[model samples]
Target chain A: MALGLAALLFIVLCALPVFYMLGVSLVGADGAFSLNHYFRLFAEVRQLDLFLNSLLLATATSLLATAIGAPLGVLLARADLPAKRALRILLIIPLAVPPYVMGLAWIYMGSDSGIIAQATGRDFLSPLTYSLTGAVIVLSVSFYPLAMLAAEAAARGVDARMEEAALLVAAPRRVLWRITLPIAAPSIAAAALLIFVLALSEFGVPGLLRVPVFTTEVFTAFSALYDFGAATALAVPLLALALMAGITARFMIGERLLVGRRGARNRSPLSLNSRRAGLAVTIALALFVLLPIAALALETGRAERMILALRSSVEAITNSLTLAFVGATMAALIGLLLGYARARMHRFAGTVDLAMIVAFAAPGTVIGVGLIGLWNRPGLMEEIYRSRLIILIAYLARLIPVAALILAAGARQVPASFEEAGEVAGAKWTRVFARITVPQMRAGIIAAWVVSFILAFGELGATVLVAPPGQATLPAHIYTLIANAPSGEVAALALTQSAVVMTLLALFAVFVFREKRLHS
Target chain B: MNDSFLRLVNIVKRFGRREVVRNLSLEAAEGEVVALLGPSGCGKTTVLRVIAGLEAPDEGEVWIAGRKVASDGINIEGPRARHVGFVFQDLALWPHMTVAGNLDFALASVSVARRERAARITEALRMARIESFASSYPDQLSGGEQQRAALARAIVSRPGLLLLDEPMSSLDTELKGELIGEIAALQRSLQVTTVYITHDRAEAAALAHRVAILREGRIERIDEIASL
Candidate 1:
């Protein structure tokens, strides 16, 4: 079946590289199977420190993000706040902008000559600008919407009658605490764990913040020291941590996590009327949504410099745009089949969910190292590994699972009876899928494509690791120049990244609105 | 002055100008049972909701236990403030709470002391004949058992007015008949003012002191139902 090939493609592209790295981690210099690599990994105090730093960073990001996002999510789902739809869209704009660009904005705000210093005529935030706490703040602000969305879904999942039953006797606040929040605990915890994994796997934020985490160390080991063994070894711990967290999150959410919250729209029982909730949403919008973006624009003032910055990094920009397009297109196409297969699958689907999340959560540095271990050999494999094709491979490995998950969520919306109706009419399975099922899920498909494109465009971690020597993507170039280049030029590049991403996001939003109108 | 404990006067409810309930008026005396019978979409549930203070009337006045609770374009009191017990058509039992916890929540809502909550909940469970299933969640209990739990939750706070909206709509004929008998006995013993909303004429005849047949959101007829 076509679905089998899509599944097989993921197994070969994503799964094999990880397995290859696992094999490499197990083998010693003598070419004998051994635990020496792991032994050495734990034995070195520097490695242990790196591991601890990564853990703390992940923990802090998860906790802080949840703290900020969970309340907002609850408000969005239950509050009778004004301009709710606008507020939700504004809050989610951060997800469109890459985390590193956010880090860059924060840096500009907190640097010695940056916004905070110039405005205040003193430097308080500059000391903590490139610190672990700074990384946590940037990553948390960038990823908080994940928690927010998850929280809203979980809150909506609570049946209206359940709350009304409580409201018959208990106060609304008591009903929320005792009935709504407790029921939503699994989703909130799952979102927290997901944030933890994402923060741990993140390379851009911590790297920019000068936080010496596993990802950065792995980069240093391979790129600077040329010690492939050491780099691969460093990745094992991060890989293990991301996989564990991803699997745990998947289990916590179960199959319902993939079912979108369309069912929640009709049942609106919990209505909160409070001025304080409105104030909280406004403050959150100003702080998390508007502030960083305003800082970025303020730092990059002139149009001419932005033009010059784009021209200078022209090769990198071209490569990034082209590769991202190709990568997103491939990911969407392949993800459709995989998503459909997964949606229709009844038995052992949990295992598939676990596998996808683990793959999707694998640290970019680890996947890059795994790809090199698997393909950097003499003959045909070496030939392909040295080309730009390898970079595309990295993108496929990193992003396909995410795309598939999105599509699967969409696919689940189509009732099984629709497909069954087609089959009963003597249509083939492919025809049934295309004419009946796919048409019903058109919105989900477009959403999946847009999300996939955005993620692919902003991808840096794995691309940075796997890019051929002397080659640079826009992100890799901007990051490399930040140390030595003028603030104006760096700001321009960062702003350009935001502009392109936002413009595409606007287009996608328009497309979705148009589709909704047509459907209506 | 109305002689009834629960009264709705010239109540009007509209959802986007469809006018669900138009100039509807009803009353139930203290410690009396009155059944409002109608076809589906006859605004029977809306009347119950208006009385329970869950839904505000567009043009009407609702008074519970001699206190004005809601009027045209204003909800003067919330469901909790009016001390009303409402069991929805679906028997909206909180799935998260155990049967005892459900009763406890009801008692707590009426601001009962934590110490007395346990005893009150037990007595409520005993009255509903579901004492052995105190630890059971709504989903864990059988349909009949769950029905008892919902009844227990409603009466736990000892509300001045009790509203039932097709509570046995999902039950089989055997269980429905049994619950109807039990509910009648409980209403007689407790002597709380009650309004029963149902489409089934048999249900109306089985429990009510009087039956009001509703058509197009208006009272078509009022007949005294002889005791079954």
Candidate 2:
């Protein structure tokens, strides 16, 4: 009964906005069924350009990310390397730092009088800096870790004995090519598709780079033009793309999407030349992780400017931290119930997974538009729309699906027999869950919270659209300051945001390490 | 013993601080089926692995077919160069490939010509009584069929030595008896030096010319199957 309520709440909170948008898009001004909005969306040259741009960006980013990430993943999973754990954590730092911050770094590095110009005494990279290619590069750098981690997990999950079986008659290289990579291919492809969807859905990087994608167009349609109908129309293609990609990814991954199991006892036979691989990894780290951060710090100039930037944006920062904290807690609590239900349900679990993936994959601008259409009404709905509460709602809508995914993966790790044992000992269902299940899921719960908080803290697309006047979050504030305020201040704020996210991730990593040590 | 086709001398394998196989030594003559019989964690599988060159012992040497394949703490020749076949406990059939494809992969690895590969694959499938499932993937086949497929893949390359790591552990008693008889017949025909690891005493007795009982990584005794 409790699980049913949680599912209902999830549907209402997460699914309703998208559904409402779909419904609203199908209706004309006369309140009758119509296809005029879609017709207009299809007929316009500008809309066509937007569609192509979105498609190109998503495709390019996914391809580049996979090309860079899959080899690293193979190395991480199979190679004999030094300080692998540390390297892994460092590589993942780009994912935690928001893409827009990376965009800001690129802007600072490639601007007319920026770092590159000052160093080289010429403005060579500025043309490529604030363009679609720039957006693709920035987003790929920010999101490649997703592909890397996915590929690594999938590779590790392959039975080592299977490779050994091949090794009996084949060289190690042949075994890897014929057996290991083929087995891990489905998962790698799925991660690439997911990266495509994420890149397609992303708003801030494109907006910063002045790339006219669907997300940025939707923002302009609603926020600049006040054309709600146009905004909803613009979201249709993006939503369709996301839905298709999510369903395809889910099919490719199946149950392994959430749960990663370690393989057999034998070590993989495939090995890399550690010195050369280490050199490549170090170079990648320099390019993808350290360069952007150094640019941000360099552009921020001095410590005093950072302090002043912090003082000026203190309200926005505080608002962001508080809202993200509450949002993450609620998301984790709700995710716990829903995730447990999804994990345990033998039937309808695929449907639940589909819904969660689609929800999570829906672009934030689309969700923002949907929320506005749903909540910007009279009475109680208007109360939410006109206050800071709407931002939290937006956060929940955008974040719950991911939190549920993390928690569901956690729930799967706790064996069913443990709960059955608790029940056999005369414990009630709730008691068994609280004592036997939740305790075992402690690490998962913490992971869900930390991930949710990071995502919510960096959330910009939905929050920017839905936040009331004077209730700007740090991302929205930094975004606005990009046009008017000094570059130093904007760089400082972006640096501060990255620092907070990195610190939280570090703490979570430390906690997880300690937990593993304790258990082992 | 001097003409043994497969030999392990004072093998010691450790995982972390636990010595899984310690000071264990054994030998099997050419065409001999020697069963390494032990309870779980008695290092039976480790011994098979050492002979196969899949593992290097920390303090021993392994010789296969008159060649030194591994020395203390090093694999002088890897598993492929040793020409040993292994059927893991889980079967470990490549799920992405058909049974024919699996066999073809093994054959092709040894530089078998494409023109001759099909005939070899067909003969192996026929020997294992799994010709009907040649185009089927491992998951598409039944448990018994999968077992046959694994066995066919192992022997398709005509390996000098064969290692079976409790491959029949998951089967019921009836199926186990059937497969054991088939395996014994296959071994007699192929005349490959074989090391079968199993905790089941009856299985060891039914298939082996000699049974070496292992207790805590040490040989307790080697009894002739006829005596048992």
Judged by whole-model lDDT over C-alpha atoms, candidate 2 comes out at 0.90
TM-score of 2: 0.97
> DockQ values for all predictions?
0.67, 0.83
Specify the poorest-scoring 10-residue window by lDDT in model 2 chain A.
A260-269
State candidate 1's TM-score. 0.96
Interface RMSD of 2: 0.8
Compared with the true structure, what per-residue lDDT tens digits does model 2 show for residues A339-427?
A: 99888889988888989988998888889999988898999989989989999999999888998999999999999999999999999
CA displacement after TM-score superposition, residue B72 of candidate 1 (Å): 1.1
Candidate 1 wrong stretches, greater than 4 Å: A265-269
TM-score of each: 0.96, 0.97
Tens digit per residue, CA lDDT, model 2, B1-228: 389998888889998899988898888899999999989988898888888777789988998878888998999998889987788899999999999999999999999999899999999999999999999989898888999999999999888888999999999999999999999999999999999999999999989999999998899898897775
Query: How far in Å is the alpha carbon of A123 misplaced in model 1?
Result: 2.3
| Chain B TM-scores across candidates | 0.96, 0.97
